[model samples]
Target: MILEVAILDVKPDLTEDFESTFKAASKIIASISGYISHDLHRCLETKNRYILLVRWQKLEDHTIGFRQSPEYQEWRSLLHHFYDSFPTVEHYESIILP
Candidate 1:
């Protein structure tokens, strides 16, 4: 599995609106292929910052399947404007520890 992470820093005074909009945008992402699950976390120290973690079956499932789909446009429209600057997204794989 692959994990997609994004650190979103919302614009000042737009956090509430951003969160509400994200509720709708979440449905768009969850409908895509290979979308296992996701979580949204708000930062304690930085109220306008959020962390989004998504689990996918493969990197292409997010980088290609989602990013290239029409649903991505919807996701962008609903949430993109809220960001202070474009968020940087990265993918990672889990490492087992004993």
Candidate 2:
């Protein structure tokens, strides 16, 4: 499995609206191939900082599978503008667990 984490720093006033839009956006991604699960996390120190944590069977499942789908445009439209800066997305593989 691959884990994709997107760290976003949104404009403060846009937080609530962004969250509302994400709810709708998540549904679109959920329908895509290899989507396992996802959750959104907001920073306690600042509400404008968010991390989108998602799991997929493979990195391509997100990079190619979802992004190539028509639904990607909708997801982009819903959540893209809220970011104060371009989100930093990184992929990781689990190697250890207690």
Candidate 3:
């Protein structure tokens, strides 16, 4: 599995609007192939800050399947405007321990 993480810093005054829009955008992402699950978390220390975590079956599931799909355009339209700056997204794999 792959984990995609992004730190979103929304406009302070538009946090409420951003959250509402995210709710709608969530459906678009969830519909993509290989989308396992996702979560959005708000920061207590910074009200406008948020973290988006998504689980995918593979890296291409997001980079190619989702980002290259039409649904991504809708996702971008619904939520991109709220970001103060473009967020940096990273992918990770779990480390199994003995």
Model 1, C-alpha of 85: deviation from truth (Å):
0.4
lDDT string, candidate 2, 18-98, tens digits: 999899898999999999999999999987999999999999999999988898888888888999999999999999976
C-alpha lDDT values of all predictions? 0.95, 0.94, 0.96
Please provide, for model 1 over 1-98, each residue's C-alpha lDDT reduced to its tens digit, 9 standing for 90 to 100: 99999999999799999999999889999999999999999999999999999999999999999999999998998899999999989999989845
The clash count for each model shown is 0, 0, 0
- Per-prediction TM-score, please? 0.97, 0.95, 0.97
TM-score for model 1?
Answer: 0.97
Colliding residue pairs in candidate 2: none
Which segments of model 2 are wrong by more than 4 Å?
none
What is the Å distance of residue 95 in model 3 from its true position? 1.1
Give the poorly placed runs of model 1, Cα more than 4 Å off. Answer: none
Error of 3 at 25 (Å): 0.6
Alpha carbon lDDT at 95, candidate 1: 96
TM-score of 2: 0.95
Judged by lDDT against the true structure, how good is candidate 1? 0.95
